[model samples]
Target chain A: MSVENSDLLKTPLYSLHESLGGKMVPFAGYLMPVQYPLGVMGEHNHTREKAGLFDVSHMGQVVISGENADQWLETLVPGNIIDLKQNRIRYTMFTDDNGGILDDLMITRRENDIFMVVNAGCKAEDIAHMRATMPDHLELTELNDRALVALQGPLAAEVLARFTSGADEMDFMSYGEVEICGAKCFISRCGYTGEDGHEISILAANAEEVCNALLGEPEVEAIGLGARDSLRLEAGLCLYGHDITTKTSPIEGALQWSIGKRRREQGGFPGADKILGQLASGDIARKRVGILPAGRAPAREGTEILDAGDNVIGVITSGGFGPTFGAPIAMGYVDLKYSAAETPIFLQVRKKKLEAKVANMPFVAQNYYRKPK
Target chain B: MTTYYSEDHEWINVESGVGTVGITDYAQNALGDIVFVEVPEVGDELAKGDEVAVVESVKAASEIYSPVTGEITAVNEDLEDNASLVNSSAGGDGWFFKISISDDSELEGLMDADGYKTFTAGLE
Candidate 1:
């Protein structure tokens, strides 16, 4: 279906994807490619073996600046924003008044401003909340016309380095501006796939040209949302809506590391008291884990997770067959008792019980490149 | 020969005393790329319109239903590892299984090739 006629919003790369035989679907209010001609499994394995280019332009990119940008942002999030050096990126979370998570985002301190990229689905609400809460002196500029592309996989460095010199010198979580294909853009040495990759944020006008330039390289192929999901899953990353929400706490979701020690002790940000209490006392239930059906069956989202006696413990958030693993794998929450790795669990698929296990995440190892200090 | 189609998009071709089953081309196209197939074991008895097997693609999974009452006499074991055969040839080499017809009289209820085409046309 054409993007203009469809109810879903269109990204700058929508036409490019259609020309390349991408099967479009509605995602986060945008018409995106769910899979290309290479298909989902092929794309999934390809990203693991080689570099995959993804048009993540739908994500919201905003720049916050002012004399008090750092201090103001620190009040809204739990990250150590004041300690972030120039050109450094930090993964952070937005919490509610009760310490419930609102969204997860990546914050980078540019030379003169703080740049943040948030989930596309939550952009509207995030922007509105920030505007209403922040002081008028703090300027929040939404880069709505910009497009972002992610080149992820083990071989991402080699291919990306050809375009931007000294890209290999930057370590994971570092970012810098570089000129590529005759356009200046911000490149961050980070990605959702848990691989040694980069995310390039460029002007929307240059999006198509940049994508085509990358695709012209022999090692790079356009990936779709299908591979994007599995890649993040294999990386053990959480999807915001599924793995995290306003109702879920960081401690309960196993994301204690994102909360700074000072924040936990000082008790600032939303719901800090409730979240800190959970950290000290512990959750009544834990967001545990589960594996795939040992057989050929693929356990999908919303499937019921059961214990030995057919009692419900948790629900599957993201479950599907992993092409690289050659078996089905999933992640979900369970009772604290059954949350341990290798614990046996049963997934009710239709009329039969499918055997599964509580496997550790990153189902595959992450290969991020970090420079030695 | 007569044919029947399931709502799940599988088709059954019945002859004098035997029946052959496979998924429809429309089903294969909607499924994107086929990666795995779970055919029923030989000698398994099936009721009309029973879920006899499963087909998995990169994006989703679907159940394949039997179109007639029969006992499975043969299954295409090759598809277990090479499920792409269904995407390439959904009707011919992609035939999922062969059944020893339990009721030859049931063939009268199925549609012919032309009738099946007309039935599917209504779907789109």
Candidate 2:
């Protein structure tokens, strides 16, 4: 995130955010709203119970084209991009040579090419990495003139179906280019929060009008990054710089499921040797596990995790109060020996050791809209 | 009862040398929704400027410092069940703890209502 203080950039919805009484703060070089008058807790619960709209224009959107784009993408990421069905999305990561993740992204196989969304903070670096490594036959076009908005929750499809036809019929991880309120947009039925939702990419010129139309629906409310973080945390989704970083491998981050089975056997992609070896032998020394604190005190990032005997075992990477759970929850890397679902761990919070247990994640069950076969 | 304010946004209402303490409305509004609060235990001795409590909002955690030299005599237990009291009524029902002033002279260094208002305005 660029906090240079020189001059924070504003999104297309800047005036709309201010009009809604959004508390703005600097994030990823853009002045973004961290919460509205509903506050973080209210917005968070509303997203779980009803629907919430988020302006995610800060994320990088790029289109990869030319012949064999999917094959070239497979070399950069461990995911099986070549086999991706048209209009389907895959969660994958760009890895460094040593198996560390450069950035995790969403890859959607469009009709004639692939569209990818990367973290805003790392977008510049990601683009540079692709330009330097990819062959001349591949084309990477940055969609800087577009805005991305996520409409999330159980009521999302119902609310969105009012404006666009065939939206409710789209299954999870599926996408299509459709016209929303007279503006053409690429809509994907996916989001960071573990809820059935859609992310709409529209031209920056039409962002404000499109978002206003969405908010006009009674079920939709404007949500800020504060609620977004807590929502993803409860869903056990990893935040880029915090939960998973260059120092940690995918196996250690517990993202093995993201690696395609064919790629695992073929031994392609960066850091394949280290990642595949660990996957085959199950020799990962540490794993990311969810920790449920016995008390209300939130064990924030950098809080030390200790054993019963007061020996330091790990450290909390992300921790906060889960409003839905009404308790303090955390996720951290713990030694594989103590990473089981029910294993008890201790957290050193403000000079006192508090007892916590390793719990299964999504601490809340995911509500993805999987189509019935 | 005279209410004195600290630079850190804590307000203490003093009566008969026993002071009731809590954060001000401005502090609560800035912190958004309050989730948890950790107050000093009864009978804990504290000096001025000591970190005596913690206020954890949804996004971040902040420390509440003691404004004057005092010993904690009683703590409001209602906050354990309803932490939103800090958000609803920051200076009244949200009072964190009551303390017996060890040295009443230290109160002179704190700001009165008008003075604190000017101090907070200058901060903006």
Candidate 3:
């Protein structure tokens, strides 16, 4: 989708967002709400304490149905898609021939088909790539008529359960098709935020009605892309374009966990040699590390990182003031020697060298709902 | 005391030889939540239109330019702990710094209250 033109596309909830006083900005060919009148900080805090609803209609949803769907998908990604149980979701990514990331995505296995959700900005290219690579028998169908919404935070399950049966009972990374307000919807027990929440896939025509009903809940507020960025950053989640790119490999991006052990041994996926080599020897030159600036100033993206001797060692990829931490939090790539947590580092912010350290990530603890042992 | 505004949405109130400077209420509202305010040093000398301070919001960082050739006399230290002052009281207690005007004639280039109101309205 070419976005060079002055005009921007709007989602089904565009007018509703405007009426709610959302600050709309151009994002990935769509005019998305960056924040509401409550502001980014308030919206972020509200999502952490209560529930925040987000319109994710721009995200590309596709269904892959065939006898060899799982086997076909494993050829492109390192994740163990073949073993993904029914209704279970696995976070994974597509890769180029050189072990570089194409785009990160979520793959959910269903009873008869596999549901895939890719980033909105990469949807066009992703569809083209799949069409070119997949076998003729596998059908890749884009669910363009559907709109996606996410209800996230600690109170998300409680609010979602009011509309759908058996929603609160689903464990983390689970999905199912159910009825919501008389509309047949696909609801998943997962979200971008580190909280227990649901991502509901509904028809575009019924999106506004369902969104309004969800917002009518006493504990829910409309969150925008602004809070979504901060919330994910605090949870130590990677943003595709910012943290991982075509030049960075998965091992170097601190996403080694996503590569299944079976795939690592089989060596059939794209760029498996280079990826598995890095995992075995641990010889990568640089690794992604979380950095916390000591003072109040936030060292944003592209800020040069320095070692103890003030020599430049790396650069910040994603950095911002974490509202929940009440201090500036950042993440960047550093020399593998200095990637260890608590390693003292400095950031060159303008003329000043700000004191910082390589800190452990998930600056906030993950609160996913897992079944107790 | 006479108040003036710059095209960049900065406001200055001149009293005697001292000029108190802060961003306009419109700027604060547009910036959303203010996370950090980099105040100019008290002894630093600045030229008119020079970038002296910085205001960082949750989404971006913006520079504040000096409205007149001046020497920074004082900065609102309260912002060190409470940067949201720019959001709550932009024109009053949220003042960024006080400067001792080096060239009083430089103030002539700024817009008055009525002119600033019209300028901001044109922007919308």
iRMS, all models: 1.8, 0.8, 0.7
Model 1, A231-295: lDDT tens digits are: 88877788999888886788877888887777778866778788888888886467646465667
Off by over 4 Å in 1: A1-5, A290-292, B1-8, B35-53, B65-85, B92-94, B97-124
Tens-place lDDT per residue, model 3, A1-373, is 4654368878889998999999888898899999999999999999999999998898999999999899999998889999999999999898888989999999999999999999999999889988888999999999999999999999999889999867888989999998888888999889898888999999998888889999999999999999998888889888888889888899999999998889888968888889889999999989998999999998898999998798999999989889988899999999999999999999998778999999998988878987776
List model 3 lDDT by residue over B6-119, tens digit each: 999999999999999999999999998999999999998999989989998887789999999989999999999899999999999999999999888898999999999999
**Prediction 1: B-chain TM-score:** 0.88
- For candidate 2, the TM-score is 0.97
Question: In model 1 chain B, which range of ten residues has the least summed lDDT?
Answer: B104-113
DockQ of each: 0.50, 0.76, 0.73
Pairs in clash, predicted candidate 2? none
Q: Which ten residues in a row are the worst by lDDT in model 2 chain B?
A: B115-124
**Candidates' lDDT values, in order?**
0.85, 0.93, 0.92
- Best of the candidates, lDDT: 2
Alpha-carbon RMSD, each predicted model: 3.1, 1.5, 1.6
Model 2 segments beyond 4 Å from truth? A1-6, B121-124
User: TM-score, each model?
Assistant: 0.90, 0.97, 0.97
